[model samples]
Target: MAEIQAKDSGGKGGKPKAKKHSTKIDMTPMVDLGFLLLTFFVMTTTLAKPQTMEINMPVKAKDQEEQSQLKASNALTILMGENNKVFWYAGLPDAPAAPGVQVTDYSANGIRKVLLARRSNKDLMVLIKPMEKGTYKNMVDILDEMNITGIGKYAIIDVDPRDEELVKKVQ
Candidate 1:
């Protein structure tokens, strides 16, 4: 909305000239429209949902020696190394008849395939041991793979010297 007003100059015994006018505009409508748009956007937009990782916490035991252990046949140890290298084996690394560590990548056909093949074994347990020099991303990728393969029984264990020796042998 605009309002116009005229300015009058004193006429002193001479012919009057054209009067000058000035325009004043009201910006209330524009301000109202701006607020309306802000409110609309605030009401219609959605906030992102937070992502989460599901973990099962172990229960406490009074005596450390009373813990139950998984059998070697059902245990699978996965070692996470640099360059996305994965070394896995069933049973302890130093045990007799235990298969030597084998190298594989983090692809669907690699670790995922191995996990899937052993998923049917009810007591199958996976122990992830990330190398000291390994990237945190390698650990995360294997954990994601563990979830994807639906392996419920799994643990993140410290790297054993024997396993580290095998890791060095692989590279």
Candidate 2:
């Protein structure tokens, strides 16, 4: 039988040594690449402003009977139809009437004028009731008008019964 033999040095009893391996990773290149990516993202991305419209949302009610009564004097209701037409009704709920109503087109200037005139009291609240087909852009424009007119205290009303279900389907 052939037998394996180890190499000896110094004519004595020394065996050949195995080559040493390095386990440490060279991190300089990796760190440089990470910094480059971070800088690129920082330079390319635009930072958005922190300003947002402060709007009060209505509480969820199980039934119309349990719905809380909102004061007519404090609340101003703006209605948006499916055709993108806007109408506004102010005063008591039972006696609600659309005054100086403009339809068929969205007018920020008119809305601004009306809101500014109506905002006699800083404590008054404005409520927006957007229909199902109402575009979000219209809502945002209305909010922008409100903001420009210094009407900050407002609420968004989801009067549509199918709103929650539609949102669920979308998600």
Per-candidate TM-score against the hidden true structure: 0.85, 0.49
lDDT of 1 by residue, 1-171 (tens): 889999997788778988999999999999999999999999999989898788988887887998886678888999988778899887877677746788998999999999999999998989889888789889889989988988888999899999988777767
Candidate that would win on lDDT: 1
Q: What's the residue-level lDDT of 156 in candidate 2?
A: 77
Summed backbone clashes in each candidate are 0, 0
Give all candidates' CA lDDT scores: 0.87, 0.65
Query: Model 1: runs farther than 4 Å from truth?
Result: 8-21
State the lDDT of candidate 2 residue by residue for 1-171, as single tens digits. 233444433343476555444355567888899999999999999999898766666667777797566676776767666655666656433444523333433665556667877889766788777876778898888778777888877777665443323323433
Please give the distance, in angstroms, between residue 160's alpha carbon in candidate 2 and its true position after superposition.
Answer: 7.4
- CA lDDT, candidate 1, residue 57: 84
